[model samples]
Structures are given as structure tokens and as C-alpha cells.
Target chain A: MTLVMAGAISHAPGITGREKMAPEDKKTRYYDACYRFRDHLWDQKPDALVLVSAEHFGNFFMDKMPTFCIGLADDYQGPIETEEFLNIPKTTIPGAPELARRIADVAMQEVDLGYSQEWSFDHGFMVPLAFLTPKWDLPIIPLNINCQVPPLAPLQRCHALGKALRKAIDAQPERIALIGCGGISHWPATPDSGKINEEWDRAFLEDFVANKTDRLLRYSNDEIYRDAGPGGQEVRTFITVAGAVEGHGGELWCYEAIPIFAVGCTVVNMDVAA
Target chain B: MSVYYLDKLMYQLNRDPMVQARYKEDREALLEEYRLTDEERQAVLDEDIGKLYSLGNQPQLLMHFAALVGYAWMDYIEAMRVGAEKYGEPQYQR
Candidate 1:
């Protein structure tokens, strides 16, 4: 049976420093929770990690944009100029066409979306990569979404897709893990951008950990984007992350609101029953 | 595709007066809308291809550009191997 693990931290310049763009110490200062959860991942050491994230700059350009671009590459790299373009590992993750095709088919059967067999990872996927998996040896199958632009995937659609991913993983023969990156109320423009929605945050956490997914998927894209910020839109990735967990109920891995640049540097661990 | 590359298209258009007319309008609009820092605004008006690419926004177009050039250059060779079997050989010879 394949094991899929997933999580996301919204883009808080604090996570990626504000003034100098100094990379945050994800291991300690930035994602303390991820570190704790990292132990569990280290233990599992799945042969491959399938990453799903939105493209801040890997598969977008002026004029035309794609809603979803899957990285079917031997590796990925961020633009050279940005500091977030740190040395993240390049992955040759197996893109089980049969599996990806099945997930896409299941999703399209339910939602209005497009599909592609090829794509690459961007800063949203890479910065975390620098901190999350830096070895550069592991293989990663990336799913890049069009979160920045509107007419994008709704929170419900992402949740449904995550559900589909779990179904796909179950069919796979190899052990697999998943990570969905992005979120926890943070703005990119203003210095005072990262707003901590503890009330909603806690409620979601409760619903997540209690396996009470009924309320979890009920939240709408408008509610989340309005509350989070246009950039906070990436929060839909969490729906997929939530869907990846075999069972519900998330343990508070760690939470921090580094307002210096407006991002909630929070991380949570979803315990999967062994 | 990166806007850096699109701006390159704009840069190539600087030689065309008509395209330059619209370019200036969209250029100013981009500055105001993106709330581009003075530095960003200045870089565009100054026509700095390198700085534009650095911002790294709307990168999907780069793929389009690569494809355009790829087809122009590689289509011939690729057509021989892949396309020939599918659409027959291209009659137009460079």
C-alpha cells in the first residue's frame, strides 16, 4: 500500500524574508511543525514523493495561462534571479500515466477542468523543496495548478481531486507520499500582510483532526479567498492535502504568525493510523 | 512563459510605431495595476529585458515562445521522424 503525506505553508515573506529575501530556516524558525512531521516522513522514507502546488512562476506567462500543469520532467528549477530559486533536488518521479490518467478522468467526470501529461515546478513548489527535500536525488511528480488567476479550481474541486489522488495511490504498487504547499492567511504586498485567522484556523484544524470532513469541504473558494487574500487563494491546495490523509484528524504540528511580512508560518501533522 | 519574454516581444515592437502606441498604454496600465514599484515601472519604460525576466511573472508564455521557435526549427527534423508518419511530409522547403 502507498502512503501519501501532504502539507502547505502560505507565502509569507517571513517564510521567505521580507527585506533581503533571506530564506527562512524552515527546519527551526520557519516550519517547526514540518520538522516534527519531517521525522515521520524520514521514517517512512517513501521511494517517491508526488507534489501538488500552484505555479507562481513556472508555467505562467503574459496573455495565456494554464489551470493545471503536471511536471512530467526529470527535474525542475526556479528562475535564476529569485532567491527562492535555491538548490532544491531534481526528481525523476514516475508519472504513472495510467494512474495520472485515471485521476484526471475521475476528476473531469465530476469537475470542469483540463489535463496535460507534462509540466514543471515553480517557486511555490521549489522554495519548500529547498527546505522540505534538498537531497536532489529523490524523484517527484509535480502537479502545478493555476491558483493565481481566477476561473481557477474551486476549493471543492481540489478536495475532490485529492480524493481522486488517494484512490490513484491505492491502486499503485509503490509506496508514495504527497505534499500540498501553500497557505495560512498571508498577503504578499503589504508588510502587515499575514493575518492569523485563529478562529477559522482552529475550526478547520478541529474538523480536520476529528475526521469530521463534512464541514471541511463545505468552505467555499469565495469565503477562503476573501478571508485569506487573493494570494491566499492557494489554500485550495490544502483541500487536496486533507484528502491525501488516509483518515481525518490532524495534530497541531506547529503554528506561527510571522507578521513581519504577513504570513502565518503554520504547519500541522495529520496522523494516519498505521 | 515569462512576461520577461513578452516584454521582449514588446521590445522587438519598439521599432514599430503603431505597436509602440499600444505598448505605452498597456505599459503604464501594467505599472498602475501591478502596483509595480518605481523600480519595476522604470525598468519597463527603460526596456530592460533582463530586469523584466527577473520579476518572473506569467511564465507560461515562455513555453509558447519555445514552442514557436521549436516548431520553426525542429519541426522539419521532428516531422521526418514523428510527423511524417502522422501528417505526411511538409511540402514547403526552406
Candidate 2:
């Protein structure tokens, strides 16, 4: 019962970088939702936040990409993009290395989890942190899923990783908050950057909130790419969160299609049995 | 096509500040390091992100390079659109 909170959200760079570029009213509504979500997360007061993220090429690259990599450093520096570009200052965030190592050690028994002594944050982790942990004081345990490259971990594996993490978190004495950040449906960083499929996103969110493993895993990568664009491939993160909170349902705190933000903005809270 | 090398160059240029400084100070010398095709070299030299996009550079890598090269967010989006129109859809994986 150490998993105090588990949920998912969107982490598009535009959520922070291009904040002012979007319409004012829409931006305020979205930010307000983020504020409420943050309040709820902080209320749980977990000892460590396990951020399951899908990074761009900030740390690992095509040279050698890992299927899953958890940070094992004492501290990690981030928003590797220029401060002028990402609009989030590069800062060193303390890491929960001992907790991370223990989780990795246990999770490896079920999955071949990789551990990294060195890692940096891209917009994927930065944007979410900018919203959820504005103070940046909470110790973090970052986990990465290879959502960008092809041959991505299958949806089932993403779920399995979540289940494994649940076992790992339960064994720890610390209260752990698990949050998965990624996509709903959108084309990001391309010509179709501002395009979002609201219908597709809502449908997927329905499946996600219900924790419908079968329905969530029904999407093939090709179908996601075709319907949700390449960015949609990041649904693996959400699928992983569902796996962590298996059998428990979720609440869709917020979901809005903010085109300038690229992906549909989403915030969800999952139930954790006492 | 040396798209893999081209992609590798993008990855390095985005990750390494020294590589970025070199890219800024001595474009030709920096370009010489990677096994880029003439077209790839020209695209980097020309700052033609559209061509790079069409050449199958991953958008994740290409986007940071776009920012590095001083593209505003809208400009980066437009560059990809124009590139797609001029060069057809991106030639991903090849």
C-alpha cells in the first residue's frame, strides 16, 4: 500500500515553452486544471515521485537506446534544451537513488529493467514537473520508456513494467507517487504539429480511465501512428500507468484539446486502495 | 542515403554544447565530422530544416536542431509543412 498516488498526464513541451502562444482563455483553463491537479498530488505528500516519462533524444539516442531506463544518480539536471527554447531553466533536481535502485532491483526480477547512473531531463519530464512540483524540491525517481524510437516496448510490456513497479513500490517503506506523462492524440514537432484528434483522444481517455487493459492494448502502433500521428505512440506511458494501478479505476480531472500546446492536455487521478 | 549519420549529427548537435559551439563557429569543420551526404551537408549549411525533415531526420532530433538554428515555434512548423509540400511526405526509415 505504499503507492499513495498513481495517474497520467500530458507533457508536451508547448505546455511550458509556448505557453503564451495559445489563446488566453484556453491557456488559463488548462493551467487552472494543472493547479488543481498539483494540489491533489502534493496533498498525498509522497516521499518520492516516480515519473514515468518518454524522453526525446536528450540522454539516450539511436546510438544505443534502452527499452526502459530508471535514473540511479543522486541528482539529475534537466530541461536539456536551451532555457530560451524550453523556457524552463536548467536546474539540478535531487534524485531518490536508493529508492530508485531498490525499485530497479526488484522490478528486474520480472522485467529486464535498465538502470542509469547518468541521465538528463527533456521536456517530457520537465513540463510535467513544472506543473506538478513547481518548487522542484521533491526528490524524484525518473523512469524512461523508449516511446520515440521504433520497436517500442509493446503495450503489454509497458503494463507489465507498471505491475512490476507496483510490487517494487509496495516493498519500499517510503510513500511513492507514480505518474506517467505522455500523449493522448496529436502530431508534435512536425508540419502537423498543432493538429489534435479530440475524438480519438476522448475515446482513448475513456479506455484509460476505465483501466480497460484489453481496450487500451487494442491499438497497434501503426494504427496509433495513422490516427494519432507519431506522437500518439507515446500512449505507452499511459498504458504503463494503467498497469501500475491494475483493477483500480481513474478520474479524468482534466482533458482539453489545446492545439498550440500540440497534444491534448490531460490530467487523471487513479485510485489506490488504503 | 546517410540519414542515420545525418540523424546522429542532429543528436550530437542537440546534446553537446561543444558540438553546438563548433557548429556555430566553424560550420564546415563541424559538418566534416559526420558522414553526411552532399544533400545532408547542404541542408545543414543552408539551415534548411524542411529538407532535413524530408530526408527522414527524426522530428525529436530535428526540433531541437530547429530551435538551435533560431527557428521560432511557428517557423519550425511552417518549415516542415513547406518541406512536405515541396518534397512529399518525409522519407522515414530510409
Indicate which candidate wins on DockQ.
2
* Candidate 1 local lDDT, B8-31, one digit each (tens): 453334223455465656867544
| Residue A68 accuracy (lDDT) in model 2 | 93
For candidate 2, the per-residue lDDT at B10 reads 92
* Cα-lDDT of candidate 1: 0.53
Which ten contiguous residues of candidate 1 chain B have the minimum total lDDT? B57-66
Which docking band does candidate 1 fall into? incorrect
Question: Positional deviation of A172 in candidate 1, in angstroms?
Answer: 0.7
Q: What interface Cα RMSD is found for model 1?
A: 20.1
Candidate 2 lDDT by residue in tens digits, B18-37: 99899889999988889999
User: Across residues A1-274, which tens digit of lDDT does each residue of candidate 2 receive?
Assistant: 7999989888999888888888888788788888988888889888999999999888888788999999999998888887877789989888999889999999988988878888889999999999888889999999999988777898999999999999999999998999999988888898888899999999999989999999999988889988998889889899888999999889998887889899899999898774
Q: Chain A TM-score per model, please list them.
A: 0.78, 0.98
